[model samples]
Target: MTCSTLWCALASLACLLAAHNAFAALSVDATPPYIKPCRKSDPELNQCIKHSFEHLRPYLIKGIPEIKLQSIEPLRIPKMVMDNGHGAVRVRAQFSNITVIGATNYTILDVKGNVTTYKIELALSIPRIETTGSYEVNGNVLLFPVRSRGDFWAFFSNITGSGKIYGKEVIKNGVRFMKTEKLLVDFKLTKSKFKIKDHLNGHNVIGEAMNQFLNQNSNEIIEEMKPGATAAIGKHFKNFLNGAFLQIPIPVWLKD
Candidate 1:
């Protein structure tokens, strides 16, 4: 073959190789398999979603505040009985004094199991700072169910309920005078009893009775509060209640 012809053939081969390299590079860059926020159509969208949540973790954590419970005490009954087929256990309890010290006097709360099925009543009194008369608040029976623990935690750490407050009234005593308000509030608890260990740990079992009372009372107080004031109060109330709930005993020691 002539030298010129051979040189031309070699040149064509070089050009073809260069073109092939460029196409391969472009294909790799344009169609990478990795998924990203900008690449929504990528096959790994699930991973991208997870990554997005991870990035947002700090903001989510900052948004939610913690709940605190003040004091829990026993009210009407000291002990209650429960039979879950595991064996019958007597649950002793006390009602808690819940105080949300700030502008908001509300809380996020949970009632586990069948809390809504049993009858509940509430009476509230607001002492006078300067006046002789005290405000009494009452409402009709309201159904507040104890929801599944897992579900309640997944939603807002707090929950809200609404009911009516009776009008205020006055009374007189022998040329003297007094005033009061009476409101009727009602609620129910389910007959079912949960396993002690399922909802609490350590000493919480023995304290279940008290925990129950605290949970019930705090919820009632939150329900009775003004709607406009709830959001601010709810977080503090939650913190107060959470602390009070943890004080319940997991097991009680019986004296021989």
Candidate 2:
């Protein structure tokens, strides 16, 4: 296949993972035999969907083979680059081999949907998050020129967030399907801690100082990078969701 054709194929395979709450809801009696779909006419549809997510959590934590979802525990992100700051925290950094823990612990605060318009809104809270990875960074932070390559660790507490899922329905082979068009998500951290082990032999002072500064002003730093961070997260989840929607028909997930 040509490059464009290959891309088209890949996208179709990932299509739309339906918001599954509002944007996505599979029939409890569908072939998948996994999802407990909510009814479009139910008055407590949102809460019922929330229960569906709860029921599906264990499978999602371990992955679902039929739908091709992978384990989310210690969720792996191969790489992330940040260079968007120009203020007191101007820096260019590449993070690699990242693993995060605590996604399975999310508490659904609210879920709202309008399948008619193919929109989904979700809210949740996470008590804590821990992450580790390798990083390379250079440029000015807190107005001081710094360069470092190291293994990094971070902790976040009391995170609260919400997101919106957007999609449009399309007809393929006379079957209705939803194609994810856009996603938006954001979150806030009540407390944060950061550490970077300076790979350069015994340059502990600079690393320690920087870590201290980062921990002390993590709120500011997080704000500086929030846009890129949230965008990357949304992109990752969108693709992951697509994996399920592509495999299952819309009628199987939610019927009119």
Candidate 3:
């Protein structure tokens, strides 16, 4: 072959090889057997979805609720800025929260020196919420280091609560399945609202609403499910429920 023709042939072969490798990689990364996405016209899609959820059935069962209360000793309170210039006072208070079905747990840490701020910590037991399983948590309050003057009282008072269960799935399980790159839980809360009372006047003031947000990289849950580890997945689930309870708001009279 002529020199020019030989050079063109070699370049074409290299391009073909590269394209083949790319296609192979894409095929390898696609969903494996028994877990393929369904097309709209395919009747098998429903069955596939159903079977996928069935494998996660254990997460759906409602186990007995378990509650643990631990008093956190006074920790060094951090300074917080308030509307007034007076230095915030340090109020040492017991901190406790609950966990239910899964292996995870959450706790209220402490209020900031100003008492206007609160801190909370959450620990998950699984890598992600199960797709076949369902979870529902309803109420107003969500998160800690309650930020406003009335947030603390309102959080405690408007604690009306409920939760619903739908389904969830791990969209992307990262390398070697050690982590889920994206975890999604599909559910809704029936009544999620927050009520704050004036720190001094005790007057009621409601706040903005709550809505669903996708939870990603649920490392908390994954960490608990480490190989051969005898962790209580149910307790973790319950912890999720209790965390939901904290997010909800109860009526003032209920607090009394």
Candidate 4:
């Protein structure tokens, strides 16, 4: 894909990881070391649940087999398609084999939740996220038309994000589960760098110029890709969370 497609990786990474922060289950004393259980009755419930993320952070990197959390480190996304037809930057990119690094390395700046209402707001900081992948993309970027198939790498740093998740209770076999209805994500990055191996028939001069253009306009380019990125991640993470939440009953980690 063109270098402009690279920043699409940063679009929802923080939001994806933030989904894990909502994963507290049951009571602390009976749960596995990797799973942090936040009591619904705790007076400082929000803070307790916020710290639960840190307690589970180390486990999320390698994944906890018992809990069925797959490795998040170098997380693999089978595919991602982003489209933006209206903007200073307009492009549609399809990304695959998208290996992402550094999603687990985050600090929870703040967390607010109303367990009864099943709504959560999370604020977080990620030092960086590195991505490598292959893709097919075609579209006009600003004044340039781009079409290509190639390997791409991108690095984003000083990332900060905020998001909210909404869910509703479901009853199953006398147990309770929270089914994610929607997750809204938004983020900003202080710096980003992008690279693509082949483009414009491998003409080094033309490719270098394209890279320069993409990096120079990274912010606006990323903005163009955000809507699609948000919807894509939101849809994927909903299923992912549903899988995890179903496996761990709500009564185990949360109570009414």
lDDT of each: 0.21, 0.64, 0.20, 0.66
Worst 10 residues of 1 by lDDT: 1-10
- Order the candidate numbers by TM-score, best to worst: 4, 2, 3, 1
Please provide TM-scores, in order, for all candidate models, with all chains considered together: 0.18, 0.80, 0.19, 0.84
Is candidate 1 or 4 superior in lDDT?
A: 4
Best by TM-score: 4
Per residue, candidate 1 scores C-alpha lDDT tens digits across 1-256 of 0001011111111111111121122221232122112232445533443343334333222321211111111001121111111112111111112111111222212211111121112211211111011111112223322211110000012122321222221222211111112222222212111121213334445335433643545444323322212322232223322222222111110000
Tens-digit lDDT track for model 2 on 76-191?
A: 66766656465676677777887777757777788888878878787777787787888888888676788888888887778777777787787655667766678777777687
Superposition TM-score, candidate 3 onto the true structure: 0.19
Over the full model, what C-alpha lDDT does candidate 1 score relative to the true structure? 0.21
Question: Which stretches of candidate 1 lie above 4 Å from their native place?
Answer: 1-92, 97-156, 171-181, 186-256
Over 83-156, each residue of candidate 4 has an lDDT whose tens digit, in order, gives 66776667777888888887677788888989888898878888888888887668887687887667788888
**Alpha carbon lDDT at 174, candidate 3:** 30
Winner on TM-score between 2 and 4 is 4
* Predicted structure 3: lDDT: 0.20
Residue runs of model 3 more than 4 Å from their true location after superposition:
1-46, 58-97, 100-179, 184-187, 193-256
Clashes of each: 50, 6, 42, 3
List, residue by residue over 214-245, the lDDT tens digit for candidate 3: 12212221222221111122222333333322
